[model samples]
Target: MARSYEANLETSDELAAVNEMLSAIGESPVNTIEGDSNADVANCRRILNAVNTEVQSMGWTFNIEEDAILTPDVFSKLIIWLPDYLSVKAPSGTTVYVNRGGYLYDRNAKTDEFTQPVTVSLIRLKGFEEMPTQFRTYIIAKAARRFNIRFFGAAEIEASLQLEEQDAWARVQEFELEYGAFNMLDGDAWVAGRLTR
Candidate 1:
């Protein structure tokens, strides 16, 4: 006999976040974005996008590596093709330099010749769905707080929402610390060290 297990699929990250925001203000969850009569789904999506942008700006350990061909010329600089590239990590076997524009330059100007593509590791901002649970909670709290402010426009509610947002962010920080996530300073140093050399 073969053993079998059942798995339950949950709502999508966007729907969950929107529902979380709705539940925060004592509203019922909806089945679909378009079917949500109580909330503006488009506006919720915009809020979620904003929250993702803000959270990503804070920097996290989310990253990916890719091989990119260096644009070899007299300038000795290489431009990364990844549009979402945030910062570059130290690559193997060679000293690479990265600029604010995500361009990589060989530290040794004489070694500009590249016969093959070089692998570059980068720290990039994750999409909303790619965020960890704690980060998603933080995003929901922030989105809720913003939604409350926009929908209610009541000073008392604003104060409470602010507190909720703060608490949510605190939880996210705690989770990050618990999981040994990268600190902003550490990431900065890693990049800065390579750039200076």
Candidate 2:
């Protein structure tokens, strides 16, 4: 049968991404994402998720929430369930916060309790579908490169995949530069000090 050369208009999904990874390692694409009974498919899915989480943890503007308020639970005033934040901190203060036992902990205050609502700036984890297209492409390319290296370890193929990975990374960086609106004042201690005034 002849394969059509039609362009795909839809954006890449988890299945597509996994298939890309599988293809990188000289494996056939799977019909479904999970429970494929193929060890290679399972490995691809795992690598994809791990790569997604790692990339999101880099704190892109898309995943960052500013001045988000997190209130304590009414039933358990002392236990505030923390969001899946990659890194979290007070919007502006010396106060440091950490995720401890899936709860928000005040490192500076030495307490896990919050009497009042806390405003924070955090980079939260977003699902694969929630990620921007540029980031998604980058994650898939990176994952494919890693999978190829882990399984096949072919020097020539790795070199080719590395080029793709680097190209994808450059695209992601370009997207960030255009949309992130980053300035020197971002996360500046001096600028944060002024917010207190």
Give the winner by TM-score: 2
TM-score of 1: 0.59
Model 2 Cα RMSD, 1 decimal = 7.6
- Evaluated at residue 141, the lDDT of candidate 2 is 92
TM-scores, one per candidate: 0.59, 0.83
- List clashing residue pairs in candidate 1: none
* lDDT agreement with native, every candidate: 0.62, 0.78
Sliding window of 10 residues with minimal summed lDDT for model 1: 2-11
What overall lDDT, based on C-alpha atoms, would model 1 receive against the true structure? 0.62
Candidate 2 per-residue lDDT, tens place, 1-197, comes to 63211111122477899888887777888777655688887787778877877888888979899898888887676655444567788877467788788788999988888888888878777767777888988998998988987878889889989999899999999998999787756557778678778
What is the lDDT, from 0 to 100, of the residue 48 in candidate 1?
A: 68
